[model samples]
Target: MNFPTHIVAVAGLIINDDKKILLVKNPISGWEFPGGQVENGENLIEALKREIEEESGAIANIDSLVGVYSNVQSYMGWDGVSYTPTKVILDFIGRYVGGDLHTSDESIEVGWFEKENVLQIIENENLKDRARDMLEFHGKVIYRVYETKPVYSVKSERYI
Candidate 1:
């Protein structure tokens, strides 16, 4: 019997004092919330803070968990390779602590965007949906699951 492996990740919808949402422009994922895979031994909140700081050079105070989003699809690996996997993303609503916006190796651009502008700039449907949900969230945690096709062809030999 084959069991599917799920990659756990975390994302932060950081809102600044100006009511703008923090966004990062990743080369592969495009404009989206700042986040990455949860490191071993780190809790989801810790992972979210670390990822936000690493990717956007900003400090985040986690306000609450917005939702859990699951997407079964092909995604670019950290090594620049492509792979199909089930990505489980925990989304959090965070408040900006401090630090100027700057991009790291993982992000091409980092900046704050208005809610309406965020919806326009983020082209990925999943990301756009997540942002909208975060904005409309009313103290309740939500769960969403998405089904997607592999963008690359898989060979039986590769798996075996």
Candidate 2:
């Protein structure tokens, strides 16, 4: 049996001195954590740092891995063809080190939001959940797999 290719991505839950979370508004995902697909030769931590810098212009130090989430859905690929792909995102808790706040080409806006406002500001439910999970993270890594589209269902979950 042939299996579909999966895209591995990394996200940073950067908390600043003001106790706010950094967020980026993307055309596709709305207000979410700053991150992107891992490039060739880049490990998860390297990709996370690069993505956070590229998307939010912020420097961060990854403290720990918060969780791993899998979202399987159909979307338009770079080739302009529709494909069902699994997006596996590794979320990490990061401490904001320094750098000016700026948005990249992939982001419409970049700003810090209070933890209480994340759910209301972020349009994606899954992303909101991820944020909440990261905020409440207690040194344990979470693993979650979801089947999206006709119905959003959790396939599996565990704490590691």
Candidate number with greatest lDDT: 2
Instruction: Name the lDDT value of residue 92 in candidate 2.
Output: 95
Candidate 1 residue spans exceeding 4 A from truth: 1-4, 73-82, 150-160
Off by over 4 Å in 2: 1-4, 73-80
Worst 10 residues of 2 by lDDT: 75-84
Model 2 RMSD to the real structure? 2.0
Please provide, for model 2 over 1-160, each residue's C-alpha lDDT reduced to its tens digit, 9 standing for 90 to 100: 9876889999989999999999999977789999889998899999999999999999999988999998977666657777757799999999999999998898999999998888799877778778878989998899998866666678889998
In order, candidate lDDTs are 0.83, 0.88
Q: Quote each prediction's TM-score.
A: 0.84, 0.90
Residue 49, model 1, lDDT: 93
Estimate the overall C-alpha local distance difference test score of candidate 2.
0.88
State candidate 1's TM-score.
0.84
